[model samples]
Target chain A: MNNKLKQLDEQAVQYIAVGAAVLGTGGGGDPHIGKLMALEAIRKYGPVRVLSPEELADDDLVIPLSMIGAPTVMNEKIPSVQQMAMPLDLIEKELGRKVTAIMPIEVGGGNSLVPVLAAAERGIPILDADAMGRAFPESQMVTFYLDGIDCSPITMADERGNGVLMHAIDGIWEERMARAITIQMGGSASICDYPVSGAQAKQSAIPHTLSLAYDIGKTLFESKDSKQNPIEALLEQLHGYALFQGKAVDIRRRTEGGFTKGEAVFEGTDAYRDRMMRLFFQNEFLLATEEGKSLAVTPDLISLLDQDTGMPITTENLKYGARVVAVGFPCDPKWRAPKGLDTVGPQYFGYDVPYVPIEELAGGKGEKL
Target chain B: MNNKLKQLDEQAVQYIAVGAAVLGTGGGGDPHIGKLMALEAIRKYGPVRVLSPEELADDDLVIPLSMIGAPTVMNEKIPSVQQMAMPLDLIEKELGRKVTAIMPIEVGGGNSLVPVLAAAERGIPILDADAMGRAFPESQMVTFYLDGIDCSPITMADERGNGVLMHAIDGIWEERMARAITIQMGGSASICDYPVSGAQAKQSAIPHTLSLAYDIGKTLFESKDSKQNPIEALLEQLHGYALFQGKAVDIRRRTEGGFTKGEAVFEGTDAYRDRMMRLFFQNEFLLATEEGKSLAVTPDLISLLDQDTGMPITTENLKYGARVVAVGFPCDPKWRAPKGLDTVGPQYFGYDVPYVPIEELAGGKGEKL
Candidate 1:
């Protein structure tokens, strides 16, 4: 895609929403809610305008906004149009200027579309990029945070129009306070964080992430309908690997410390009948291993999907007795840096394995895509 | 106490600190630490000036500053001079003006002395009044909150020099966010909350609270030294009553939801033999009942003391088999109003009884002194 403005219709929104679920790695939050919001927003206001980062002027204020809280609470609370627009309204007043555009803090499930929902309400455009190519549990585990952009002065508002403005010294403090505030606000709140100049947006944001999610989603749908191998098409689009194919034997899940932590064990079938695969998740899927050996770990994308329909399975929805396939893909190159690993790597999630690209683990090419 | 400027020396600091402990009702924090800090500050700065609320200019900025978090953690953390000063420094930067004076958010235990420590560092006078005459579990449970003062833009700092600034809609939000922030900062932090102009301060703050605390402490010391009845002097000073004198038979304690809740039962002795007194506490001692009859309940002050020595006993230090006495005094008149009672009354603490003045329960005059 060139640096021209684009229009996002209902169809594009659905594709991007579904694709973001795949990248969510099981954590980001349900996409159905975001899809409904996005479609209604597009229909109510015309198709939202999507601008490439290069199209923004140097002095423009680009803010990344999304929902911060337990996905379980978010599911029950549901987003109201007013609640979605609240953070942006407060930010504009605090900054004493109109925001140029809204962007996603992370491209995962509902987060990828929350900015779209807010921007449509404000009659503003949405940016085509995201701060994190995928979602992580904490706010500080993003490229912007790693690159040392100030995450505040940040503003957030709950469903009741109660609001808080925070100026924190670092992104870790931002995540800590934001999580606490979300719980205080009855488990969910909307936030406008990581404000940056248009120039900084171009430098730090993961580029074309919306388009990437859209294409990834579109391909998955087409492959399933055409009776071709959906998993293979997904691997091709992401330049990734087909990690495993199996039937889920047992799934153990628990919500702990505000994140869903679980393990799903799969008995391999097809070409790998005797092997066993294990998947672990904390909000998002964090690790995939075969025979207790490392297959893939974050900050690499590891996702689980229904084997037949190729529907992405969220951490909260992972069920026993379902046939599934696990796919592994390299994350954005920005996530491979030392600082990025310190922020989002498997060790950051308390896993013991050193992070290796899925391509390397798959005995394929061992270079950046 | 007249509306005159006062200078606080080490001796005066000790009196005020001890007096504040009684006002703490039972929470506030350990007064010993506050006493030490106040003495150190007065020595280093050559005594701190304290002003009457009427002496301030209309435009003078008065900030209520205090220590927030678990008193247990605070005791271990042992605040550094820099940590205590950090909140003031950040607030000054946020306010864009030098604060004219520092006042305690609540004149209870250590909270009463924190402002004195900060004021000496900035070479500013301490305010003789406080937002709350005594400490309650939360920041919103203050007279200033009842009088319609916005609780933010508020600033707080942890021991590590990490800082946070929040703009909240009301004191409840302020308390919620500040409590969470304190926990995140490792369970103890310094906060500058409820910034108000001098005129507003006079209208809302409980007047001359420092002197009230000072006199309480001075008399307790004097009565003990003169071998006169300390309990009589204490009751006479506050126009209160000695509800019971007995031997503590049982004491049960636990920390719950950030507040300390406990029950101490004392078997009657002396003139109260064969009767029973029960003391229930949540941070502050909330109630005293004799034979299941409500003798004193918040927002009335209830305190426990060593019967023989007349030394004040904190809720945490209440011991079984120790001879003790229970004292009851009326809270500020502001807290007796319907709105104030609604905010900090016994009902707010989950007690079933309607609040009655200590004097009324004692079968004496019920009118406000």
Candidate 2:
């Protein structure tokens, strides 16, 4: 885990933005504003060092930071670097000490980029790892949470300078209180939480996700100029497969628990003309099915891209009659554990299906209904 | 303003408990739990000194405290002294200073007693004044709020040790965020907020509310022994009038936005037979009308008592077919000011009526429907 540290440059943020969107599973948050903010911070404060988790001092204070609330709100109400840095500063003030490093609580879309601004300003390294290799709607659905890290003494802030500090007995309650605060703070807030020792970060975090996301993002970006299909490039990078290519026929959405929850129906085109695909999501795409059989379920990353443009489509942007391609990739092997399944598997998303690698579910076809 | 102080003994707690209930205007909280807790604290920590608003240094810190969320939740989930004390201690730590005094944010129901324990534990004086002489649903409906005291740096705690510190731009935002937190904290939590200087408190607080509530309670208590009607005693103390005498023929209630909001219809009895009286409320009773004319509107105190027993009936305990007498009393003279009307008048309650004194609305008969 302790390898050469990388610099969080402008070019890297661009790729990570795209990669994070893919892994975001259509939740996280809009990456456009986050990218702009991160770019400005890195430009103003110099590139932040991406430190390997194993390089952490045993006593170092490693805090996880992200935005919590409706992704739609994140898209509309832009957060400031001051807002992003507030929680970090408040945490330091509350503990009456300095935070040694910053890290993403989850790596997905805007979440992957939001913390970069803070890390840049503090002139501290950001851990090259994250709690969730991909975004999760709730804070409790993380390896760190499962490993018994109390995500309390958590601080949050809005662009208008409103702030809240929360401490709960457990991760779930923390998320509950944080969500309410976010909703009240005009729906989107910057959060700094899950304060853990460097030793704990090294043991519990999913390693090299930042580098992995950056690599995936680079591939997607380069493919656009190389005349290679971006979707195919992403599939090759993830060792995933094209699960379906269809026109979204009907989409139903409703907001619940501070999340956009809905399902999309797709009528397959091309070779799979007669096939029907259904996708269910709450903040993130958690389940995928064809006709009636379960094709993929969470812990497996399910992402949808514009059919021609290859840009990752967020849940908030999903619409009827859009031609899109859905892909499924296997998650970090650590997520295959029983407890991991309990944390974010199909059952956690209310789907009654056993975990199966996306490759196994796809069989031989790169494009399956 | 510095006159004399009273010691908060168990006997005073009992009387203040009753007084606060009458002033709670049907919304404060469960008086039983608050009385029990305040008494226990007084018994264990000894009596708290009741300070007059003027009895303070110019810079003495006066913190207002209360229980926030649904009265129903307060009834179901009783809070402990540890929970009550968490916020005050957090505030002290946040401000890096000792709070010199405790004041009720609202002198109604359990709110009047929630601060006593904090005063007892700190061995500080409890102010004999409050933000609201009678209960109002939202925090912004107080004179302190109208006077522009920022409600932030407010802290709340739950029974399970879950706590949150909120800093909002204004009192309304504070209430919005606090309401959401209260809902998540199992619908009720103890909060200590609006830390102001002694000078500010002396200028803005509704003075003598503690003694007013106490006097009302004592009058009711002594009247019970003397075979005098407690309602008449209460009215004498408030300079109010009997708005109506009737059996609660119909009661409609439903929980909304974490508050019990609805109305009750009463069919006038005896000399007022055939006339109907209607009471509208949200947490606290906000208005009363005879047929279509307004008899009372907030910032006036509206209370309902058992027709025979003379015990106050909270909105949570309201039931159909109970014979009750409704009374309306003028609020503090300060509440009749323009700012007060804007804060809690009939329009704030969605009623298309102007504020009118209960005595003026009563026409000729004290017992008129």
Candidate 3:
């Protein structure tokens, strides 16, 4: 994989949108809105420069910019460019320094692209790294938190011009305060948090996740053009497991406490017919289970793809009766550590199941037909 | 009416406590805790200097500091000195300037004295003027808001080291965001907002309120020594109307949405023995009614006083079967203006009653036996 992503143009934004959605695991807000926002920003302000973590100077200030709140609300309420950039402005003002670069807090569909708008507007580079290698529902689920980084001086802005800057003692407090503010800001807000020095970013950040997303997206697009099975091509590229191929039968979703939380039941189709899978989510898909046994649990990635087009389906976009392919990829090795498992594992989300690795659960080569 | 208040000693703190409670109008949290906190701060850090609005230079940076959230919660969860000063520290850090003086946001029981702890600790003068001459429930119900002053750069801190700084577009947004944060900070928090120039303070603040509070408290204390009825002296001093003399028969209060919201029912005594009064409050008493007719409405002040001692009683301390005298005073003339009435009026608190001047409702004399 060529990892030298230098700029985000229209084509690059498209590829990253699809690839980030795959990494998003049915969460991180609707990818369509994020893609449109990023594309519009790139078109208006010219291409945003992509900076790898290694290139950052030791003292350079890097801030992660993203959207916080229910994906359901975000789907209907699209934020303006000013709203997207307000948090960056606030954080810069609070820190009394100009930001060196903007990074996504998570490598999720919308969050991955949200930073591009601010970066382009400010004429700053966008870092090709993220705090969370893959998305999790809460703000505290970032790798920075696991590394014991201080999540203070967090900033947020809403569409109505309300701006907030918080100094939380820890990541948990940041999540609690930011989520409450998000709910008050009409269920969605653009946020800038976990501002780190270049050295801290280099030490704690999950590097090259953006490049990974771009590659994934490109693989799917090329597979489609070549008339190969796109889902199969995706599984092969990521060494992912095909958890299930099913038609969505029932979906129960509700927006509560600034999160889209619910479950969906799918009736297996094709070679996996007669089997049932229940997928649960609190923004991102947290767990996938078949007949009470775990197919994939959080800290790993579980994404739903359009069976034919190989496009990623966000939790907000998945519909009943749609045939989809569920794929599972092992998470970054860091997440397998004790602290990471305790943080985003099944039990942390109140699930009774254990977090068995996707590869182990899939019996090594999970090509279910 | 000697308004030459120079410093806050033990005696001064005692008087302001009682007098502010009277102005607080049965809200503003428990006066006892405020008095204790102020007295302790005075003992530890020496007397806090008092500054009149006229003493401020036009460019002097003045900030009002106070407590936010349900008084019910604050009565139990008393904040530490650091908690009281954290908001000041945060606001200073945000503005990149030291505060010239700290002022009380309102002339209410606990709120009126909360700034003393910070002022004394910082060795800065405490402004004798306040935005609200009498207490109102929400943060936006201030004279500064009425004068169209900006309430941006608001800061808050909880007992647990969580500090928040917000740049709200307006006062209403400040209230919404600050109140939400207050609830998240475990029901109560210390806050600093409406930081203004000394010129703004002189133009918009209710001047010499701390002195007025002291006089009110002194009158009540001296009246007992002079063998005069303290309540009668208080009514004469403030030109206040006695709304009712009754026993607290029932009170239904609940802490909800960062406010102590409820109503107190009083069974009349003495000359008005056959009547009943219902006093409704959201932090401060917004409306007082006798048999469905409005006796008083906000931005008029309605305070409950102990019948024997003539000491002011907070809404939290007004127990069942306690004999009391409910007094109504005219709010500062600023609150009589259209914008002021619109802000703290009975209708604003959803009482469905129109605001009427206390003089008109009391038949001028207001000397009901």
- Pick the lDDT winner: 3
TM-score of 3: 0.98
Instruction: Write the residue-wise lDDT of candidate 2 on B1-369 in tens digits.
Output: 122338889888887888888889898887777799899999989999999887878899998888888887788887787887899888888889999999999977689999888888878889999898888888788887888878879998999999888888888888889999988888888888789999999898888888877777777778888977788767766777888888888888877787888999999888778989999999999999986988888888899988876678888888889888988887887778887788888988799988987667776447633
Query: Of the pair 1 and 2, which is ahead by TM-score?
Result: 2
**Candidate 2's residue-wise lDDT over A105-175, tens digit each?**
88787888888888888898888888988888887888878788888898999888888888888988988
Candidate 1's docking class is acceptable
Which run of 10 residues does model 3 chain B get worst, by summed lDDT?
Answer: B360-369
Rank by TM-score (best first): 3, 2, 1
Highest DockQ, which number?
3
Show the colliding residue pairs in model 2.
Answer: none
Candidate 1, pairs of clashing residues: A27-A283
Q: For model 3, how does the per-residue alpha-carbon lDDT over A301-331 read when each residue is reduced to its tens digit? A: 9999998999999999999898999999999
Q: How accurate is candidate 2 locally (lDDT)?
A: 0.84
Winner on DockQ between 2 and 3 is: 3
Query: Model 3, range B1-369, lDDT digits (tens) per residue?
Result: 875799999999999999999998887767899999999999999999999888999999999999999988999999889999898988898788999999999987798999999988889999998998888889999999999999979999998899999999999999989989998999999999999999999999999999999999999999989988999999989989888999999999998999999999999999879999999988778889988999988888899999999999888787999999999998889989889888887777888978889889888879665
In candidate 1, what are the lDDT values of residues A88-147, reduced to their tens digit? 876786687999999988878788988888788778889988888888878898888989
